[model samples]
Target: MDLNLRKAILSNIESNDQKQLEATIVEAIQNGEEKMLPGLGVLFELIWKQSDEQDKQEMINALEQGVKQETTG
Candidate 1:
């Protein structure tokens, strides 16, 4: 089967307003389904690609803190 996941997801969300996008992301995370991971990954890819160095560093720092919290707390 041929598939274009990223294209399809982008198309699906293209018209979404900020609230709609937030709801979609929140619902996906709250549901915690494995099937939703690819969509979340695509969203993360979009964020990463658009971020500048400082933004990327902040994201990395936040991720590091999250990992540390997970391990230590």
Candidate 2:
């Protein structure tokens, strides 16, 4: 069986509006199930693809800070 997980994730959310997208993300995160990780990865991939260099840098910076806090706190 051939499965395109990224395509499936995109298709599932293609019709969502901004609020719906926010809700989806928030709900998935709150649930914290391993199955939701792939969907979040797809969303992050889309965001990364669409981001400009500055935006990418900002995300990296935020991620670095988050990692540091997690490790040190």
Candidate 3:
């Protein structure tokens, strides 16, 4: 069986409002389940595709800082 995770995730959340989207994201992260990773990755992919160069750079910087914090803390 071939499953398109990105499509599935997008379809599921396509009609969500800001509050609903925030709740979904918060629930997924707070659940801390590995199954949610693909959904988060798809979300990130969407954000990356929509972001301008400066936004992308800021995201990279934040990721770098997060990685460093994880390693050092």
Candidate 4:
């Protein structure tokens, strides 16, 4: 079977507005299901692709801080 997970994920959320998108993300994270990881990753990939260099750096810094906190806490 041919499956394009990223395309599928995008299609699912394409019509969502800002508030709806936030709700989807929050619900997915709160659910804490392993299956949601791929969808979140797809969303992150889209964000990364659309981001400017400064935005990318900020995301990296935030991620680094999150990882450090996770490891040290």
lDDT of 2 by residue, 34-64 (tens): 9999999999998999999999999999999
* Best candidate, lDDT: 2
Least accurate 10 contiguous residues by lDDT in model 3: 38-47
Write down the TM-score for model 3. Answer: 0.92
Candidate 2: residue 8 lDDT (0-100): 94
Q: Rate the local accuracy (lDDT) of all candidates.
A: 0.95, 0.97, 0.94, 0.95
Collision count for each candidate, in order: 0, 0, 0, 0
Candidate 3 local lDDT, residue 19: 97
Q: Lowest-lDDT window of 10 residues in candidate 4?
A: 38-47
RMSD of each: 1.2, 0.9, 1.0, 0.9
Model 1 Cα lDDT, one tens digit per residue, 1-73: 7889999999999999999989989999999999999999998999999999999999999999999998999
Scored against the true structure, residue 11 in model 1 reaches a CA lDDT of: 94
Clashing pairs in 4: none
Better of 2 and 4 by lDDT: 2
Q: Highest TM-score among the candidates is held by which one? A: 2
Q: 2-73, model 3: which lDDT tens digit per residue?
A: 988789999999999999988988999999999999998888898899999999999999999999998999
Whole-model lDDT, model 2: 0.97
Residue pairs in clash, model 1: none
**Residue range with the least summed lDDT across 10 consecutive positions in model 1:** 35-44
